[model samples]
Target: MRGRFSQAWSDVLRGSAFPHEGQAFLEQVFSADVFRPRPDHGGREERFALTYERLRHINDRVREAGSTVPLVQDRERLFPLLAWSAVADPALFYAMFLHHCMTTGAVLEFGAGREDLADVLEELAATERVGALLMTELGHGNSNASVRTVAEYDADREEFVLRTPEPAAVKFPPAVAAEGVPRLAVVLAQLVVDGAECGEFCFLVPLRDADGPLPGVGVRPLQPSPWLPLDGAVVSFDGVRIPYRFWLRDNAVLTADGGFTDPFGSPAIRARRTLSLIRFAWEAAVVGLAATAGASAAVAVRHAHRRRTGGRFAAGRPVIRYRNQQRALFGALSGAYVARLVAAATAGPEAPALTPRSVRTTFLMKVVTDRIAERVSARARTASGALGFLAANRFLDYQGFAHSLNAAAADNQMLLLDGAQALLAGTAYTPPADEAPAAGDRDLLDPATWETLAAVRERILHQELADGLRKATGSGLAPFDAWNGLYDLAERLAETHAARLVLGTVREAVREVAGSDPVTGPEAAGILRDLLALHALEELAGHDGWYLAEGLLDADEVRGIPALLDRLCERLEPYAEELAEALGVPYPLVGAPIAGEDYVGGLAGTAPSSGTA
Candidate 1:
């Protein structure tokens, strides 16, 4: 049984040397003492306290291993833990990412050569102080280039005075002081020297200590975020002085004569390099969202398998016997697998340099995964009925994460539009190779056929968008006006491109898994093939109209998708339990009573301890 799915899936999901170690760490720290199910009802402060404790407990255990953070030092191990964390709690996941990936990652990457920064990193690693990265401001949310917060060089004092020039300049959503833990942030502010703007740069600044907010720093709590709760707040600075040594520079120096010398020729490039740590944040979001999506589907499937109901045709039959339940639950499960596969390939340990192309790739991968998570979680929640609505069931946790990730790094829609504009303007985009119309003649169940159709659609859409823009611009329409004329198609093109990219990633993984594991190789290969087929069909089903319009498919083919989906769902029903258990979400983390053998008995807190099967 273990060889069937859990072991095979675990081998594929973890791309690092720390698979067993990661699982051990989760089991050790997530014992009853450190980990607890979220309360059915709790106040904001109460919930915030739980999130804080969760962060501290995990960091404490990691410190016990070594002085330097292992995962941060070698991020190959980060995604596995992030996925597990997301299955547990979205808020906990948020805090963990900010501390380990955002704050600690930035320091490790750029805070070299500074003894003060080293001390701060040590404290952060030891969980003595919390960490955050503040780049977005209330005034210019998501527009980092136009941040109004300024750090003016005080040459006489050999320091920088960091100040939020106005109310709008206040940093929003840092969760800085409410935890009552010592906190530090890597802040992005415009550098000003002698009344001249010197591009955006990062600085290490202390935001709070055990006592309270640091002097010259003001913190105000914002309303708790819906579904996903954290101690988020808006922070302002009043002449907060930062020592010259605190500046995070990448071989950039301040000359004694008050001149700045940077090896990177341009400030824009320097700024991009400064915020490159954001890639880790994106990776974290992908892994976490993938895990949550999978876990949600798992719980929903388990419930559907056990849940019995009466209908006009049958009495006391398992809900999984019904067509509606199978479609909702199995489809979600298939999507979950697709999401996990995509994350495994895209969010690898190796970090790519930040560029327009890489940024777009990361953004679109995140967007695609985010959409999958949202859809899977919503279907899971609905499939479970009233039981799913209960906080103790854990479906809501995935729902919250899915919704939050859509806007977490930046709003997905805005990013999609921005990415579309870049692609339209030829920002290093490589469209999928155009395929011949005959490519569509292959069986719909063939992954190759899905890949071909998706690629052809993307290529056609890109060409149409480019030609439309050119024709409109040549007709004397403003660039924005011309682009606006095809806004719907532009967005569709972006989505199709993202879907193709994810499909390409899934295909690669399937090929690798087919040849890699000898023990359960055939079984694993069979499972992946089925999942890949279902995922591909799901992606193409939505654009059936477009596919028919473009002659990629005939009316009969398009009309057959519904029945095809139902058949796929029925085929996957037997393996649903194995798939859910193989996701590696600990039973305790799910905390769903209905998922247990005896739902009624388990409701009294008699569920088995949290651990993998």
Candidate 2:
């Protein structure tokens, strides 16, 4: 048992290498997690109390590392943990970050605020800590060029006095302080260059000295976030004096004399690097949520397989006897597997090219991950029966993660539109869309992006990002079937090209790394070949409607996809455990909710610990 747990820990860490275990572990530890059925006949209320207590303990740990003091003092440890947690609960991601900055005595200039910052995080990180930055007003999220927060140079006092003119100019949804005390605030007020607004730059302003609130910084927290615990707030400035040197450089370089130097290309590019940091977080969060859902399904299946009921073959056999249960379990498991692969592969980052295809792929992958997680979790919860809804069962935990992931970010949709735009631009992409389209009519090849994907793909989106976002706005299609729809023929072509890019690189890398290995070895090179074959077969399969209209595929090759997937699943079956191991998820033994082959009795969390199965 100890060995298994250790191995499980190793597997998880191998995937993330972060300080914390994924949230899925949070649900199953000591088997006292949420979603657990009452064991030893304990009262449901008692069990729930236990679960909440467990969660609170974890939350306590989160506050400890995520607080401002921890962030400032132990930044190295804190950043990795924050990145990892983003993989788990992205909603908690930014909130915790803001909390850390406020509690740790750091200043925000463009994104977060300063008023009451110290108080809020002090409760979490300890007292007498605060920071501030009120840059993003209610008027915009990324339109920095249109910013209204003004900071004019007061040459006499040698300070920049900041002010907010209109209500929209007030930075609502900005990071703020609690208890009205702040130490340092780098406000992102528009720098009045030669009597004109010269873009935006952060200015270091002392909001509160050891005595009290500085001079002109004011704030208000958003009443509540839509889903997650987003402690959003509004902020404004009135003649706030700040000594410079607070601007996070790499974009709009500001000289001490108030002159600007933005030599690294456009301001948009530089600004995007900052957004990339958040994007990294979203990516990590989406992946983490998917993994959590996978664990939830695994647990639910363990319970379902053990809980007995009437069956066709046996007299009230295990619930796993039901086809409905298997369909739910296995289908979700497959999705979890696919999602896990995608997340692990894409979790790092992509390039900063604002190209539509790249944006489309990124957005599609996010939506795909989000949808799979939400759907699988909802199904898994139902599979757990009444126990799933109970706080003790841990289903609600997964639901919390899923709903939160679904409730953030509008950029995902924009990415999809960008993908459509990429498709329109004639970017060729083709890999396997189906196996043997037309039963070995190898002539169905489409253009592939072999060159670009082969070279540099950037370090995690060309810089920083913690990962995951929920909210879906715009066409609502992103939340609906946008991810599900088959893209245009051009899109399929792009997919084919993209798949080749990935597979080709993998094929080459495997040659160097797995020269003597099996499956990946020469003996099993067929698997890789078949995988690529399968990819190509499927890539063009989706554009059948358009393909048929455009004569991309003849009538003979259209009917082979089902067989292809069927064959692929069968071929991939023998290597499933090996592949799962390589990917770093724990094996089935550790995934059991309790302990039983049938997943019932004492193991299902319903019965007492009278005997082991």
Candidate 3:
């Protein structure tokens, strides 16, 4: 079994067409041994301290090797690195996120060589100064426009006085917690000048000197959790003052005469522009969740291939050969693959700027990817049985991380509701007519068939929602009441739109792989085609009710989906290990001791001496 798995792994590595630089970087990361977790010290505080210490060491190694330069400077390498580091460790991944995504982006976008900030951008890039983004408040969450934290202009001193009026105004979870004092923070506060509300803007506040928190600033660490090992804190400000120039005034400015001016006519527009920094966090969440899901799938497949159990046909056979086990593990593998493609396409460089459409796309991507991660991790854990329940296996850790990803930067349900609103407003997506395939094709294996199915479903759902909303409002229902009546339809429409986007992305990826390399193109395409079909069938099966109610498909077609999925899974069984390997999670990062080669033999050696007793 080990020999066969190794051969399949080799085939996958040789068959897939990864970018040259990404492949080389992945090789370096695996060879460098920088991502190993520290041994447990049997206490929460001790474990947290050890995890953070390891995180700093990993950061130093990453910096020394310049592994993150590509991520900061080039868009092409960002997704690959994001995918790889996410499988390493959550604490380390968050640290890298602070350094590359939060700190570097904040400095480059807002603080480059500004005299008021004392060239903080250069310091941030060189790691001489560390930074955090303090945007979400305990009371307001990410509703920046309504946050209680205030930055009032002091006209006499030409400074901004920052204050947290209530306990709810405190910022919690500022990325790099418990590591040390952060030198700077991009604070989101309601800007007030002369008792008039100007708007919400980010002010660069100095949080700490070499010794401790700056005067008037307070930082208290939250209780430790083994699930997410960051030093999360509640940070408050009491009349903390900084020069007016420290305000990130790209969208609005404070005049010397104590007047506020913004090129954008409305304060709402300015606030929207100011909040574009959330895109980076969204991308991080998407990529990290996808990577975690992929890693979980890898571990599950490895365990399934090694562990044997009694079944109807045999006394002892590999668990992976069972139909139920194959469906669970392969289904997870497919979801992970789809998630990776979605993350890459949504956050890729060519994606539009931070417009409403792009924002909606990012939100949809987050919701879809996070849901996929949750489902995949759960399925993978169950497939691994007893071994999966152990913390040392890391599946449980992945599951927690997946749940946290859904709730982290933004809540998944809220994001789905926001997408629903977009649909109601007719600002949501509509597939181009030319791209839709001809109808009545039962070949679920064809990419065009799946594309057409997704597009048609989205169109039908959107029209249904539009009609229902119009009638409810026309009948004198209140605006909120009308929306409430159609809330379920609206949510379904958003999900359909996301499914269409995922199918389109998967089709494009299959084409890219098939066209890129002559030696491995056909082999890779075959595997991806099977995975794609499984993904489409599974989605269709879940939405069978919608299809039947809309007359999109006859009952026969709906009933045949299970059989089709089974066939596809059977065809994919031989290549399950290969497909998991193609996801690029390093073997060492699969932390389950049972997932290793000699688990059975090792357990035998450690068994108790029963005869003497």
Candidate 4:
């Protein structure tokens, strides 16, 4: 029964989230011998070389199979492919992500409908020239709008002089320079025409060739992070000349008179559009994170079921039988499923363009999903005991990957604050309808009740922020003061909004499952619904103090959350191995010793103890 339901649940998840191309890549390329994890033999350069080798191997396999790396424009195909890579290897995933999503995506997106960029696009598609994106400066942090890199147009030469003026202007932490590969980056810089700043634009700047870093370009690799080793570097440009054709102009015109004209009259709007490619990066990231979360949970649960502990009273019981252990493992398993559902909703060919609405949603999605991945990975690592710390088990690697994302793409907290500020500025955010009578009106077990509670919290917080903002400003506080005074509320509102969205996505999956496979499907659906309740209860418990103070959840109700959570964990306990299997992570990809049938036998120089040993 467990096996049947596990297979059914796996079908429901992978069938909904991964596209055919993505599924095929995972089965064929990712499962192949070339993509397996190998021991690191040397130092930084050698590790980076191995990453590139894996990347080249995958690229070759994909090409040989008559498909190229899917760009952000084809994110439905792109995301799942990246997700599988992330499951296989973090370093390989990071390199592939940058190459396909950041670099190739920038060229294809920013240079869309332009004839001049066709050749370069082909080179990127063919993996001839590696791609990278340079946007965030060392000093500017998340403030891409304030970057000091300048591209001054020299009319006489018809070339743009790209320069990082001061120490602060150097682009930080992109793996732009590899030893033998030619690399190009879509660099964001303030464009100047005859000393007049004409907003920021992306320019295709060459960073390196076979010889070394290109003349007038500087690349200094940063200190290696042992957990996630990449060829990350700080790059600076000293008057590197960019040709006229390399400008990634979208409906912008430059004539012989040294004047620039754009459809967007507002400099702010243009700047937003210039940084729009980051949206795709966010989308790609969550998908990879979803996969990592799932893979991590799968590894932990598999290990839990096989390993035995508690010899004081019971001679040897499965570690998974403990309530505390069950919580750690199943909580992660549930979070992984929720994360995947959220990722599935966010990515696809039908994903909206860079509109105001899409921007806010995607930003929130990235921030929330980053936190989910972080929490899920941490729990998975803890559940596996000492084995989780080993690199070969992949739990530490998964945790490192998740931690890196919290800062990469964009800092998660900063993204939330920015998103909250936008929401506070009259951006359209419809609170979930007032359906459930405030708090005590519905059954706790109903998914509808959880959804309503989450929505209500978000709505109340949003309203409170708005009312406080008006009151503060009316009392003669400056605009900045008004915002800073209520900063915490705004941040909470953003987080609640994201949690609400995640809750809704998980519930949607439950309903879909409930509607399918009348026989075995109902069992899988019940398991998923329990997961949804678990996720909702977890979020609600986090804000229980707030909920109690707000008079939404009484003290008694709040106290009962732990017991309810335990019950959910207990009910789901029998299916722990099934849930892990349902995540659809390949067996080779898990590759943890304790997860195997014979844990002691799998360990090096270890044998099963005989009774008389």
Clashing pairs in 4: none
The positional error of residue 119 in candidate 2, measured at the CA in angstroms, is: 20
lDDT of 3 by residue, 253-361 (tens): 6678898887887768767776777777787778788888888888788778889897677868999988999889999998888877776676565435667787888
Candidate that scores best on TM-score: 4
Worst 10 residues of 2 by lDDT: 460-469
Task: For each candidate, give its TM-score against the true structure.
Answer: 0.94, 0.59, 0.89, 0.95
Which candidate should be chosen as best, given lDDT against the real structure?
A: 4
Cα lDDT tens digits for candidate 2, 65-182 = 4444334344333434443343333433444444343323233223245443434334334433334335456877534446788877655555666889888788655444333334
Where does the lowest 10-residue lDDT sum fall in candidate 3?
A: 8-17
- Against the true structure, candidate 2 has what lDDT? 0.46
Per-residue C-alpha lDDT of model 1 across residues 1-613, encoded as one tens digit per residue: 2446556665665555335666777677777454666545377777777788888887777667664544665565567667777887888889889988888887777766666676777778777878887888888767666788999988888899999999889898787746577888889998888888777888889999888899998989888877888788899899999988888865877876678777887778777777667777777888889888888888888778777897878988989989888888888888888888878777766776667888888878888889999999899999998888877787777888888777777778876787778877788987777664573466887667777788898889888998998899999999779988888888888888788777777776667677777776767767767766777887788788888888888888878988988887777777778877777667777667777766755666566523223
lDDT of each: 0.78, 0.46, 0.72, 0.79
lDDT accuracy of residue 178 in candidate 3:
46
The TM-score measured for candidate 4 stands at 0.95
Question: What C-alpha root-mean-square deviation, in Å, does candidate 1 show against the real structure?
Answer: 2.4
- Candidate 1 regions with alpha-carbon error over 4 angstroms: 1-6, 16-18, 67-70, 113-116, 353-356, 437-440, 516-523, 604-613
The lDDT ranking, best first, is: 4, 1, 3, 2
TM-score of 3: 0.89
Candidate 3: where are CA atoms >4 Å away?
1-18, 24-34, 39-71, 76-78, 112-118, 175-179, 209-212, 349-352, 428-440, 517-520, 601-613
